[model samples]
Target: MTKKVVYLHGFASSSQSEKAVLTSAFFARYYPHIDYAALDLPYAPDAALALIRQHIGQTTEVALIGSSLGGFLATCIAEQLGCRACLINPAVAPHKVLHQHLGRYYHPVLQQHYEVTAEHMSVLEQLMPMTLKQPQNYLLLLQSGDEVLDYRLALDYYQGASIKLSEGGDHSYVGFAAELETIANFCQLA
Candidate 1:
């Protein structure tokens, strides 16, 4: 059977992320039988989830690979869709983290400066249900030295899920390709 895989990137990231690009290439070459999609999410979580739900609703079996904020979004989607997910350096509490992001920043790709606001943070919080209902459906990948988020938060939040901890890597997980096999295995594609 052909497997469906969707990759969702973090905030300020896009479908063109190095990890997404490499993973797409790897699957294209080695697992030609599988289907893949890389999502470029909107700045808002609701819009992103809508797009994800639409795509997932079309497939009978699916696997999700999400990074950072995308990972938090992925977990919510997986719960609703009953699909499996691989979360890489996921943000466990994005609403709280956004406090530090309340300023304007330029997006290199979009060539625009965007401000993080309280409303945006509230929207994120509203989208996330208080508790993770289906922890068993997720595989958490954490790096001890993530500069952006506290890895311990994810470790504790997803304590029930399968976890892979790397000793010293940043939030981007410096070398994500090495985890492709683990991701595939977790998704039951390996």
Candidate 2:
């Protein structure tokens, strides 16, 4: 049985994200047997899901690690696939939150320009799970100082799941490397 782990980056982000790169390296160095991939998801939510599906075809032993909006997508995929996931500073309700930020934007890291529209928010709303079917399958990592998002939302949304809260960390979840071991154990990488 081949175990796999996929790292999903956040909105307007890419596989080259710092966290994604670190995770890929960590998995490569420590868990050589488990296959690991961090793909650059498309800008659109639907396309992103499609890309993830295409990449993960027929893979049984899989775990997901998602950040921000990627965490939202990972939750949706994890529920559909019945896999475990680790959410880092996840966006609990990006549809409602991002509604105000609808406009053209540029990502320096991705070197791409994209637009956020009402349709995108609609798709995100559709992806939102009304209720968690398997809360035990989720590991929530939250920080108090996330300027971009309100961490309490994740705390409330993922009420029954295992949570690790940190103080004074930014939206990027400062000191993310410290949680790799816990993430590995939760995802059952061994």
Candidate 3:
């Protein structure tokens, strides 16, 4: 059976993120037969979860690829749905870290200032029951020089999962085409 891959972007990011776009294009060339879906999560975690659940419910074999906050969501969904996932620069402690961003902020692409509140932090905590679980089902891709998030936190959280830590790469981990192949291989797509 062909496995379906779902790509989820980070907070304030969309399906149009450079990684997402490049992933689509790369897969189109390397794994054209595999089905892929990229969702624009915006800032609605519950809505994104619902859409992901609906999509996964329709498939038997599936893989998820998520970046940053989306990685946190992907881990939640992977646990709930019993699927495998690839997490790239995932936010292991988003609730705590996001305390610095507790205010309304504008997204240039979305063209709106969205509210960031303690309630959202509560929701994030509720969504992430623990930092990590079922490590065997996960492949974590981390960069050591991520300026936004502390990569060591992810390393510690995903201790038992397969990990690839690259030096000098930022949070976005751009210009790593070979890393995509590694991720694909880990997801058993290669």
Candidate 4:
């Protein structure tokens, strides 16, 4: 069967992120048959999850790749959809992590602005998976030098899953290019 990969962007990020772009290019160059989509995720976690879930419903053999906040969302969706997920420095507890940004937020790269109200934080709290549902369905790529999130959180959270812990890389997942092929293989995009 043909495969699909849904890429979720980080908080305040869009489909224009470097990782999203690289993911798209990787599919275009090496796996033209795969249906690759990178979404311009909304600021509201509820809306973003709804949108991605909608896409998953229409796609074939759906798999997921989520970065940062996207990873958190992907985990929630993967739990619901029973699909595989690849998380890139994903948020462990976004409800707590995002509490700091519970106001106006802007994205310099996408030049977009949005708000994260207390209600949105509540949605995150409600949606985050309390316990591991499908541990075997996850593939984590963590960077120790992530300035945004503590890598150990993900390491501990996804201890039983397949994890790629890099020595030093920022939250942006520097050197993500090197792992594209491996990620593709893991997601069965190859």
The per-model lDDT (C-alpha) reads 0.84, 0.90, 0.82, 0.87
Predicted structure 1: clash tally: 0
* Model 1 lDDT tens row, 10-120: 988888889889889888887778878888777667778988888776775889999999898888888777789999999887989977778777666666677777888
Model 1 alpha-carbon drift over 4 Å, by segment:
103-115
Best of the two (1, 2) by lDDT: 2
* lDDT tens digits, residue span 26-96, model 3: 88889988888887665656767887888777775888999999899899988876778899999886888
Model 1 / residue 144 / CA error / Å: 0.4
Model 4, residue pairs in steric clash: none
Cα lDDT of candidate 3 equals 0.82
Best by TM-score: 2
Error (Å) of candidate 1 at residue 159 is 1.4
Q: TM-score order of candidates, best first?
A: 2, 4, 1, 3
lDDT of 4 at 147: 96
In terms of TM-score, how similar is model 3 to the real structure? 0.89
Residue 165 CA error for candidate 4 (Å)? 0.5
Against the true structure, candidate 2 reaches a TM-score of: 0.94
Candidate 2 per-residue lDDT, tens place, 81-174, comes to 8899999999988998889889998877667788889999999999899889999889999999999899999998998899999998999999
Q: Which candidate number would show the highest lDDT if scored against the true structure?
A: 2
Worst 10 residues of 3 by lDDT: 39-48
- Please, what's the RMSD in Å of model 1? 2.0
Q: Which ten residues in a row have the lowest lDDT in candidate 4?
A: 53-62
